[model samples]
Each structure stands twice: as C-alpha cells, then as structure tokens.
Target: MSLFFKIPFDKKQIELAIESLELQTSAELRVYIERKKKNQHFSAFEQGLDYFNQLEMFKTEAKNGVLIYIAYKDQQCAIIGDQGIHQYVTEQFWQQQNRLMIDYFKQKKYNEGLINIIANISKELARYFPYQENDKNELDNEVIIK
Candidate 1:
C-alpha cells in the first residue's frame, strides 16, 4: 500500500522550492519520501542519513547538502544537514524547524509546510554560502519517492 498517492505534495512543487533555494546558495536541498519503513527499529533520522549517504550528499564540495526524508505512511520525517551546514546552525535551530513542520503536518498543510521550511533553510544557506556566478546545482532537485 503506497501512501505516495495519498501524500498531498506533487514533485513539481518541491522541485520549485529547491530551485528557489539553490538560486540563493551553493548549498543543496533534497527531499525523499517513502510509503513505509524498512525497519520498525530504525528511527527516521537514522534512515535519513542512510539515504543522504546513498545520494552522495556528503560529497558536496562545500559539504552543505541537506536532506528531508519522509515516511508518509508512518507520518515521520527527518531533516539532515551536512557538516558545513552544521557549523552554521545549532541543534536548536533544527529542532525549531522540525517543530514548525510537525505543527503544519498535524494540520495537513504538507505543501505549505515544506515550501516554508525550504525557504527558512535558504536564508541560512545564503548567508553562509551565497551563490557564485559559477555555481551550478550539483544535486538533483527532483523529489524522490521510494
């Protein structure tokens, strides 16, 4: 039973959000969604890191890739940032963003919540890693569903 159809967001909306974010920073942001969990014991954060690695997020020249992993059926999600982003943002910042997102999810505002979250992250990324003339989007903006 894939929850993919039930998830309110369309890939284009997420892609547009990522595109807007990347226009302001060299940093990359990606979204990954899955219908269910592979292991009940694994936390969303742990599984996010696995996909982050598999996506080669850590290989960014600036180490500024960010991943938003969601298990729609489980109603759990995690946001992960590479070391470069960690240097600029505190744990509390991430927690705050998570809280905000959860609040929106509770209201079923998936599209609005994710778009806003990406915008918030873009501010920090722009501050620390402002876009360069030669900067290219090194990561795919296409949302992934698995």
Candidate 2:
C-alpha cells in the first residue's frame, strides 16, 4: 500500500495535531506511517520498535521520545514511548490509548483517532516532561510516510 493512497487521514491535519501537542511539552512526538504490509513474522509491537529505532527516536535529549506507528494495510498501530516517559506512565495507560485508537479505526475515523491519541499523549508528557526553558525540539513535526 502506498502511503498516499492507504492513509485516509489528511496529512495537514495530522501535522497540525502533532505541532499543537509538541508545543506544549518538551518531549518529542512523531508519527510514522508504514506503506508496507505488516510483517507476518513480527507483531505490531516489534515492528513499531524497529521503526522507532530506525528513526532514532531514542536519541532525544531527555529520552522522552514517543512514536505513533501505523501499519495501515494491516489495520494495526503501535504507540511507543521512550524510557523517560514510559517509566512514569502505566501499562494500562498505553492500553487505553490503543483501545481508543482501535475503536476509532474500526469506524474509519482515522483523523479523529490520531488527534485524540496525540492529545492524550500530550497531557501525559506535559505532566512528566514539562517544557523547560532550554529544551530544544528534537524532532520534526512532519508525518513520516514510508
């Protein structure tokens, strides 16, 4: 599936959502849209981790990077947060985000799903990794369509 054709959500909306979220928090947030079919040999979680590393999400200054990875063809997505944020959030929190996203996806409301997820993540990130004066934006707001 091509990123252009498979992702039903508007690229501009997604980028705006990301920008709004990151502006309020110091943590880096990125959305990666996978054009390839989900690898049968790996679970969504594994594939997400792979992309997270490939994108060097773990290299953030505060180690508070988060990746929202979507495998559109497989109808699966994964939310991965680096250790700085993970250690403060509970597993249940992550599960809840996943459930909400899955629910929206089932209804073909991909844009709403991503916006909600980014909002929720921003709240948590603000709580733990509040923006500091010297904090720098570690990543781009552009949605990686690959």
Please identify model 2 stretches exceeding 4 Å from their true place.
1-6, 35-38
Model 2 per-residue lDDT at 82:
94
lDDT of 1 by residue, 43-119 (tens): 98899988999999998898999999877667778899999999998888887887787788788887788889899
Report every candidate's CA lDDT. 0.87, 0.84
Error of 1 at 52 (Å): 0.4
Instruction: For candidate 2, write residues 16-64 as lDDT tens digits.
Output: 9888887788999999887554576887778899988988999998899
Candidate 1: global Cα-lDDT? Answer: 0.87
Task: Determine the backbone clash count of candidate 2.
Answer: 0
